[model samples]
Target: MSPSPSSRFRQQLIVAPAVLGLALVAACSNSSSSTGGGGGGSATLAGDCAEYQPYAGHSGTTVTMFASILSPESDSLQQSWAKFSSCTGIKISYEGSNDFESQLPVRVNGGQAPDLAIIPQPGLLAQMVKTGQVKKPDATTVANENKWSPVWKTYGSVDGVFYAAPMSANMKSLVWYSPSAFKKAGYQVPTTWADLMKLSDTIAKSGTNGSKPWCGGIGSGTATGWPATDWLEEVVLGGQGGDVYDQWVSHKIKFSDPQITGAMQTVANWMQNPAWVNGGFGDVKSIATTTFQDAGGPILTGKCWMLQQASFYEAQWPKGTKVGPDGDVYAFHLPAVNPAIPNPVEGGGEFVTAFSDRPEVRAVQDYLSTAAWADSRIKVPNATGWVSANQGVDKSLYTDPIDQLSAAELTDPTATFRFDASDMMPAAVGSGQEWKSLTAWFAEGQSIQQTARDIDSAWPQ
Candidate 1:
């Protein structure tokens, strides 16, 4: 039996943080204990800022934001609201991502919609637009804030109207390794694709002594093949560059294109080999945590040498593990596959969506766009691994060294920061067909040609 995409997403969600729920609710309640004296007991409207204007005015309204229940990354949104409330006098509430997705359609159909929402799934957002359930965000609202990354703006748009602004971004092109193991083995960090393969080959040939080189796990309950897809995407983007990658994601190019085929071949060659993945590639289908926790295992237990995953993996490292004078884990930029096609980084972002149309909802949005809101809520006491989307906040606010690295990577012009291709695409393609197709390739030993054909056939053409 294989894990389903929904179950995988759920598993990933569970391990991640849902800290936003409590913070959002607290921001809405008019208790001086939480709010303190700021913005005259409310967030100031856009006109008040002079730099930006409020989207709409519902001076005393309360809006509920639907977010992912498993998102620890949402603390930034809560902080934004707290600042919004202090600057303007609006209150905001937030719900889990799944809860909001399930309830949004019902509420919109029932005339009980929230003024705003922040759906993690782009397809759902598109559907809302199709049904006239969402309003296009005013361009001016996000003009000053580079909240909409070029790629996201395209996917989140329908009929040329942008619906949401990207709140925070994730980095996926990171390969974490046990520095100690690498040093002991006399292995140097690979700077190019050829060197990367050579490194993997060396690790594979070397019998597992204290460290295995790869922590490949495709198991996440329902979303079984996602890890495989990540491998495919990273390799393809690194080898083919952004243009070809974009074409495939947008259905402009076939999944079976030579570029994509080569990418899958690379993954198959690496993963199918005996030494590349600990417990063998066969074990990928059964390992839990999507091998996320395992990524740190090689270094932590000295069993594996490296794990390629997003920066979020830093949070999953065993608490109290020591890496050096610093913590136990660290991440390196995914090495460039070719100098021609820069190594593109993969990530996810959160947005604020509205389910209501009151003045307060507008006030909350306006408040969120301010610096004070970003500083207080985002710089939460224990949250060391989060970043704010608002470009105005201080970089020092990001306490986690890994997060700081992710932030730095995001700003590089040579690197293309693309959302997880599967996550950004329509759910039918991303979660349904893509998951099934890729997992079948890995688990059932399906042909690369067949896998690519299957994916193209399943695409929403």
Candidate 2:
């Protein structure tokens, strides 16, 4: 089976599927009480469903959604629509599976497609659109999409026709560190890529609070080398800037081009350096064997001080873990090569698309595209590490400091936000060779030249 991005941003593998059904009860506060589009929501349930009035009149309807998002986040997503389900009498049956990426294609091809799917990769979404199975969005959804950044609409579109709406977003351009450790060590977060390098060197010389400067693992089952890809991506986007990065992704430049190899070398200098990495694990080779899920665990024991990962990593910490500048763990923006380069924050998110165009499904799709739904989703109480690019969302509702930081970076008008390159690239190279070759570079000591050459050769012929 083709590897699905189901494990790209989320690399944790599961033996039993993390499937879930909607409880369908919700209460949350939002500044946008007016449901901007769609029809009325269910009026039968408790709490304020006024904002969901646009989705109303579908009381007897049910819309089944399939996606890669798992347990806790799935719970928040299901709860997000509780009020809508209550007010509109719509039953939103949601199922989550790590195999969603691989299974979605089979389901669609086998004519077992769900009412909707949360496509985490734009490339996969493009494939679904090409199959002629995914339905185009309704006018309301198109209008709601118009409210987002053009970059987002472009991702949800193929050949300039809109088919899906952007869902939740996670920031990848982050370096996670124990805040208390940093403070105790008197190490300030770096503000530029050069400063970041210097900080790494400084920490390698003496370690952080008596622990190694970094901990890393690329293991995500079949997606072993993806974490390294994220490293190279941000380095390219920040070091070479967006235009060059875009050219590389589109194949205007070969994967073996000097620019890309240079980025890979940079990753080696940091992550593969024995002195700087495998802090809590073992030698550099340990990274290949370490699961991304367990890579950051050493930070808790003070064996590893920092790990570069996405904002969603907040959920990786054991329950009751504190996250903030003054808390147990927090993240700082991975800086650009220089202040002159616009911060190119690499991010990942889902596009909500449907296989059937039932009125209720259309209503759900239209509602998802609206800011009201974005607000509702983000307003899931006690849910940490949630961020949305929707301009209409109230950022103040983000009680988690990391969520605030991520949202500020994601929604910043001046920032150059790029979708994950591997997710957007053709799968032959992105999921196959790039992953395989990068892991060799880390585990087998393959040189940047060889890794780049291999991946370049693997690009769809």
Q: Candidate 1 residues 1-461, lDDT tens each? A: 10111122233332222223343333333422333222223332333332222422333445666544344434434644453443333456555443344556677788877677656556656667767767655544456356434665655566677766655556778787766666767888787778877888787678455344676666554445666777778887787877887787787877888888988888777766555665332343333334433445555766666777766555556656543313456667777676676557766555555544445554455455445555665466655444554556677777667778877776666676666667666656776678788878766778999998888887765
Best of the candidates, TM-score:
2
lDDT of 2: 0.77
Query: Mind giving the per-residue lDDT tens digits that candidate 2 earns over 1-461?
Result: 11122453344332222122234334522234443223343233234655665566566667888877665566677777676665666677877775566678889999999999988777778789888999998888888876678889998888888888887778889999888988888999988878888888888888755467889988875557778888888888888888888888788888788888888888888888888888778989999999887889999898988898888777678888888888898899999864778877888877899899988899888888787878877787777767888888887788888899999998888898788888787766766688899899999998888888898887776
TM-score of each: 0.78, 0.89
Query: What clash count goes with each model?
Result: 42, 17
lDDT of 1 at 219: 57
